[model samples]
Target: MYLPGPVYDVVSVDIGGQVLAPEQYRVDAAGRLVRVGGGCWPDCQDMAAASGEPDTFTVVYRVGLPVDQAAVAAVSELTCHLLKGCGGSGSCGCKANRNIVRYSRQGVDLEMPDPQIIYSQGRTGLSLVDLWLMTVNPHRLDSPSRVYSPDFRYPRVQQWP
Candidate 1:
């Protein structure tokens, strides 16, 4: 079975309340869980029981791309930007000039980009943070895209009494 995300590691796999040994299955590079030794996953499981109960299949895994040097740099930049003037004097530097869309002093003029516009475009005001965001998610999707079909068997959920 293929997992939805880029799985980093599989911690455990449980079926019918029994934790399967690592030798029983292996996760492929593409995040597909393949059964080993000719064993097969159950075609159907009882959903009424809580996960890990009898007739349940559960997979514990970590998802996401592995953090690299570029990711570390991006996060550090964002953290520094957010922590600006956090431990300073009575005046918080970060708070000053936050809402000044336009400013003029001594024949000098400056215009600040509106924060709402940046937020609406799924970007942070910080350049490094926004660059990293754009590199990773150019489309600015809130979640991964999924295809739905009427024939698909979605898990049952008790929605109403």
Candidate 2:
């Protein structure tokens, strides 16, 4: 699942979201594929339970704004990203998804989709960040909190959107 380079133009990185770079993957002592962090791959389990308010959650983004500077400038919307089950306590059941497929990449046009990700946790105002630059405050998504890839390859873009 490892891509050679970084995946850009991201919107939202939610629990069970997909697409990641090689460096994001986590391996074990045996060099086994473990987990992928950064970017919203919603399948992360750690984001499952209520870490904050009920019915509201915060989302982050690691964007590569080579194109469409407008969207990059006005960074107040939901874009495609994922979490891979980081806090589920041990559940391997949800599919990785895009928060807002059309708004994530180039050319596709539509209102910035709001990923209505209702975890057992809750919801609140959304938080989008330029994760590529800021490296001070890091948070985990709601699924696949644990990184242990059955396959040796790292996480990659699902090519769905």
Candidate 3:
């Protein structure tokens, strides 16, 4: 299958763990990693860079087909895959890989999507807002004395009159 973004290879459970797969490698002429040949369509270096920052991350939505329920289910499925992603769910702010991995069917009810982004602001390198946005537990990696999310911001929508 085609994994849409760059394979940042969430390899181990931590930022500094041994890797277990082929990831972004450079090509002499290419200068950047050759991701096109790999299954990853969009290069992931940019996203990874953002994730490793102090207070930045992104949430993206892509709809392959607009109306099919199955297509919608793909969102949940994709989200599940993301949650199950290799880096051991440390910062992607998602449920344990089990819940997402075992899910075979998809529906809005089963979908509690989380962010694909990460930041280094809070105690665990992420804020509660980040976790909440990604449907992940803010205390997943807590050490019993962690404080609130550092980047917890409540942005309201502006209604134009």
Best by TM-score: 1
Query: Model 2, range 1-161, lDDT digits (tens) per residue?
Result: 23222344234333333434445544332223334454433343444555343333334434232445444533533232223234453232234343544543476565533445432223322344344212222344445356776787865434212
lDDT of each: 0.78, 0.38, 0.36
Lowest summed lDDT across 10 adjacent residues in model 2 is found at: 76-85
* Cα-based lDDT at residue 7, candidate 1: 77
C-alpha displacement of 131 in model 3, angstroms? 31
Better of 2 and 3 by lDDT: 2
Better of 2 and 3 by TM-score: 3
Candidate 2 matches the true fold with a TM-score of 0.14
Residue 49, candidate 3: Cα error in Å is 38
Using lDDT as the measure, what is the rank order of every candidate, best first?
Answer: 1, 2, 3
| Tens digits of per-residue lDDT for model 1, 1-161 | 87778777778999998998877877765567888799998888987888889889998988877787767888998778667657564243466666889989999998888877988998877777788888888898889899989899865332111
Distance (Å) between predicted and true CA of 18, model 3? 61
Name the regions of candidate 1 deviating beyond 4 angstroms: 85-161
Residues 1-161 of candidate 3: C-alpha lDDT, one tens digit per residue: 23244433322211222221333322222122233245433223243454434333232223232234544454565565566655675554443553352344555335433323223433222333344534433455554464688688644322110
Best by lDDT: 1
Give the CA lDDT, 0 to 100, for residue 46 in model 3: 45
